[model samples]
Target: MKRPGPLFTLLAGVVLAGGIGITNLVTGTGVTPVAGAANAAGAPSATEAPRTEPPKTAPPKTSEAPKSDAPARADYAGRVEGGGASVAVSIRDGHAIAYVCDGKKVEAWLQGVTVGGKLDLKGPKDASLAGSYNTAAVTGSVTAGGRTWRFTAGPAKKPAGLYRAAPKVRGKASKAGWIVQADGSQVGILTTDDQSAAAPVLDPAARTATVEGALVVAEPISGVDGAGEF
Candidate 1:
C-alpha cells in the first residue's frame, strides 16, 4: 500500500482501463455504447447514415397558375335607314337617339336629335316636283317650313296607267249602266266596243267592261259622257 503512491499507481491503472473499456462496450464485440447504446444500437447502428428522414420531403411539386387574355363585351340593336327621313333610331349605351318622322307621320318632329345634327334634308334643287319623293330609302331628311323637304320612299313601282276617281265608285248607278265600286254596285254596260269586261259589284265593288282596252280600273267608274270612262 505504501508503494501505491505512484499517483496511486497511476490511478489504479486508469481505473482498470476504464473497467476494461466498459467491458468491451457492453459485450457484443466492442466500441458502441452511449448509454442506451443509442437505444440498443442493434437497430440504430448506422449512426449518421440512419438520419435518412429526408425521404419524406415530397412537398415541393406544385404548379397550376395561368389564364387571362381579356376581351368580352357586346350589346346591339338596329335601324338606320338613311338621309331622306325614316328615323326612329334608338341605339342605346353608345347613344344615338333620333325620331323625326314625315314618311307618313309617326310624328316625332325631331326629338333628341344627337349624332352631329343638321339633318336638313334638301329640297330646292330646282323643284319641278311631279311625283319625286325619296329621302334615301328612309332614315331621315325633310324639314318643311324651315326648308329641308327631301321626301322619298313612297313609290317603288305601280302608278302608270288608268286611274279615274268618282269618289271611287262602289255600286248602283245604271242608266247606260256604270257604277262599279263606290258603294253603288252595278258594273258593266256602257259599250262603245273596246272589249274587256268584268262585273261583280259590291263588297269592294268590281265593274268593268270594254271592247278593246282596259288597262286597270278595277272598281270605280263614272265617265259615260262626262268624259271619264275606262
Candidate 2:
C-alpha cells in the first residue's frame, strides 16, 4: 500500500538485471568463437599454403644428326696382245676380265677373251693384276724372247711388236713369230723356244688389236648394274 523509495527501486532493477545475466550464462546462449569464422574476417589464420601447382615443366628438345656418303667408282674396258698371245678384257665397278689364250696366235685371232679376276698393277708379283683394269695407264718392263722389254699403256704411245712369217717355199707359209719392241725400240723374233721367257706387256701406243672372228660384249655387274641404291 505504501510508495517505494528511489533507492529501493534502484536496488530492485539491479537485482533483475543480474538475474538475467546469470540465466544467459547458465543456458550457454551467448555469442561464442565459431570454428572457421575467424578466418573469414581477413585475419591471418592457420591455412594451407596456397595450393600451387609446380611451374609447368617443359619437354626436352631433340637434335637431328647428319647422313654419310658412299665412295666413287671407275668406268672403262681394254685388251692386250703379244708374242702369239692375246687377252680380251673389260673393266667395270673395279672389276676386270682377262680371257687367257690356249695358243699364242689363237688369242690374237679370237674376238675378245675375258679373265676371271681383278686387275691391279700395284701388287707384288702378277697378283696385282687381279682386280680392276686401271693398268691401261701404266708403264712397266716385260720379258719376251729372252730379253727385257719396257712397255706402257694408255698414253706412252709406244709400239709393242710386229708379226711375220717366212715366204712359202712349199705350202702357204704358216704364221711364223713376233718381233718385240723393247725400251722404245724394236727387237728380235718371238719363237716358241722363247715363249716361256715372255712376260705380259702393256703398250699404250699399240693399236687396239682386233679379234678376227670375235666380238666383245659387255655385261653389267649385279647390284651395281642398275641404278644404285641409297
Candidate 3:
C-alpha cells in the first residue's frame, strides 16, 4: 500500500528500536555493575572501606621476686682456754667487728665484711685478721701490732671480752679513748684543746705512752663489766 512518506518513516523507526530491545531481553546479553563485590586477590573493593587490626604487645614485668630474704647476722664472744684470752665479735648487716685479748699480753680489734662465712679485718698499724666464721663459733687468727693469735670464739661470759684504756694526758683538754683489744694491740686518737693527733705508740705491758711529753698512764677498763679483771 502507498503511504505518506513522513508517517511511514516514523513507524519503521519504532519497529526497528523495539526489535533490538526485545532481542536483548530474550538473549540475556545485558550486564550491570554490582553494588559490592570482591576485587583482585588482595585488593579492596571500590565501595568498601579497608579493615585493619591493632598491633600486638608484650606483657608488663613484675617487681616482686621470690625468696628475697638474706641470711641473718650475728654477734659472738668467748674465751680461749689454752691462752686464757677473751674474744668478742659483732656482726651487723654484712659487716663484722671483733676483739681479742688476754688482759695482759695480747689485744686487738678486727673489722671487715662478712661474706660466704669468711672475714678479713684491717686495723690501725697495718694490722690484719683473716678467718672463717659460723654462728656457733668464729675460728680465726688476728695479726696486729706484730703479733698473731689463733682463737676459736663463742658466747662471752662475764669478765671476758673487750676493753678500752682509761688514760688521759695532762694539760690536754681532749682525752684519749683507745680500743685496747685482746690481741695485744691498741688503736686510739689523741685530742687536745688545740687539735687532734694520732696516738703515740705505747708499751702494752706498762699501759703507758709518752704522749706530748707526758707519761700517759691508762687503766684498762672492760668493754663488758669486770672483763679486764684478770
What tens-digit string does per-residue lDDT give for candidate 1 at 1-230? 34456788898899999998888778856764466566665666545465555556666887876432211111111122443323222222222222232232222212221223222222233211111112222233434323343333321111111122222223322222222211222222221232222322222223233323322344322111112221
Point to the candidate with the largest TM-score: 3
lDDT of 1: 0.29
In model 1, the runs with Cα more than 4 Å from the true position are 1-3, 11-13, 27-104, 107-230
Please give the RMSD to the true structure for each candidate, in Å.
20.7, 16.2, 13.7
TM-score of 2: 0.25
lDDT of 3 by residue, 1-230 (tens): 97679989999999999998899889877645454444645568776687888888888887775542323455455554466555666665667666655444345666778777777888777767677766566778776547666777664332223333434466435554344434545445555563445566666567677766777775544322322322
> Whole-model lDDT, candidate 2?
0.33
Q: Residue 60's C-alpha lDDT in candidate 2?
A: 86
Error of 3 at 203 (Å): 26
Worst lDDT 10-window in candidate 2: 215-224
Give candidate 1's TM-score.
Answer: 0.16
Ranking by TM-score: 3, 2, 1
Worst window of 10 by summed lDDT in candidate 1: 69-78
Per-candidate TM-scores read 0.16, 0.25, 0.40
| Candidate 2 lDDT for residue 61 | 75
By summed lDDT, the worst window of 10 consecutive residues in model 3 runs over 221-230
